[model samples]
Target: MEMSLQSMQLQLQFFMHKADDLHSCLVNGQGHVERDALAAAVVSFLYTCQPYFNHLESTVRSTRPQHTSLALNIYTQLLDIYQQLCDKLEQLVLSCASYNLLCLEETEPNSVSHFCVGQCQLGQLKLTTFLYCKPTPYLSQVDTRLYKRMRWNVEKLQVGQKTDKDQGGESKEREAKTEYYFLCYEDIPNTHAETDWGRPGFSDGNVVRMWSIGQWVQVDPDPITETIDDWILCDVPQANYNKLLFLGIEEPSCCIATDYMQQLLLLWKSADSW
Candidate 1:
């Protein structure tokens, strides 16, 4: 069924009114703007209004109207609305990501990055990925520290394990089953092990000193020294204990949001190698 130009104009006007209401609601509460809600509204508007734009374009192209200038004016208005919708979407996405990052600072205060020089390896493994650390019972009542955990996804180096198979009463070699490692972070304060704290940001003479706080680990499925030695150390500072913690990410916008996520308004993209 072919809809008339007048009908299309009415639909466009209705949506334009809705867009105005949305804009007014968004701007009224400047301090307490609901970013996620705004983002959702922008997305919904884009979805709903896309068909109208298509219909308008088709009507303008297919129908050789008597008054071409009036049709062109309506098309221009539709294009302007479409551009505004796109701009709103961009603003909403950025606002939501930034707001989420700010929330993390208060909610997870101990995880923020303190110092950086180029890229830190310790920061790379833990920053943006989800973690699950097994909390151990307090070793002593005097020690009130909580467990800081890191989740590692480590793949087996070889395709399969080496095994012997019987072939015509003669032993033949076969690949063994592939193994995987599930690792977590262990907050060991003495990871420095008598080594000099040579990080060049803050002075040791100050009240706060930089340190190697702990290391990443998984329980040895088989006690192999080589596997144990490959664990990455958690190098951080005593001062950043109360700030938001981030690990493994190279360029984070804030504590919990990474550069990639900041670019796309998604969740923080992990920078972990292993």
Candidate 2:
């Protein structure tokens, strides 16, 4: 049996209350640690509320009631709630991905694009998309400190293999944990690596410097070629370290939160519609 408008409105109202609670909680102390949980909750709310919007819109259309204005009022509130959830999701995702706080989402095209541009290192753009998601983090620009350890093992392993029978009852067993390094560029806030606002603003000097350094090859190297590089890196920085340590070296990659990626996708989709 089909439900009445009052029943559906009640359900939506209940969710609206929960959304308010979530908003308050996030505004209270949301961070990288609990961002994924918050995002998941938002998504759950959106999943439940979306069909209601569709149902209401359909009801308005099929019924063709004279009180369309009242229906529009409810519809507007539903859409606004959806948009707010999207914003919150984006915020959580960005924090998780940038800081490696462990938020989750999906692997959609738009997500891939946002994560690729934001998560992947600047010099590794030339690498294939398949290669970009590797656990190694940065592919092209690895720190020499890692190479030093790898080299030490390469030579030491040879030495150990050759002279194993040194003691009377025991062989020399060398055990070492393997590790890797990644490079991330951080943009100093007021520096040239910053993106300017639409009409009047300065551009990213760091990407320009990378372009000048023969690392980044822009598709369109026009007079504003530097601007193009900066544009691509609007979400990236010129120098930042990882969230943890690996054998005394900082961890090697920047990872965008899945929730944030979804938020950007939603925003991109919304803009596409406009």
lDDT of 2 by residue, 9-28 (tens): 57656765776676665666
lDDT by residue for model 1 over 99-205, one digit each (tens)? 44222121244322111101111211212222221222122122424333222221223233444455434443434322121111223344333334664333333
**Cα lDDT, model 2, residue 209:** 12
CA RMSD (A), model 1: 18.4
Candidate 2 vs. true structure, TM-score? 0.27
Model 2 has a clash total of: 13
Candidate 2 — what's its lDDT? Answer: 0.35
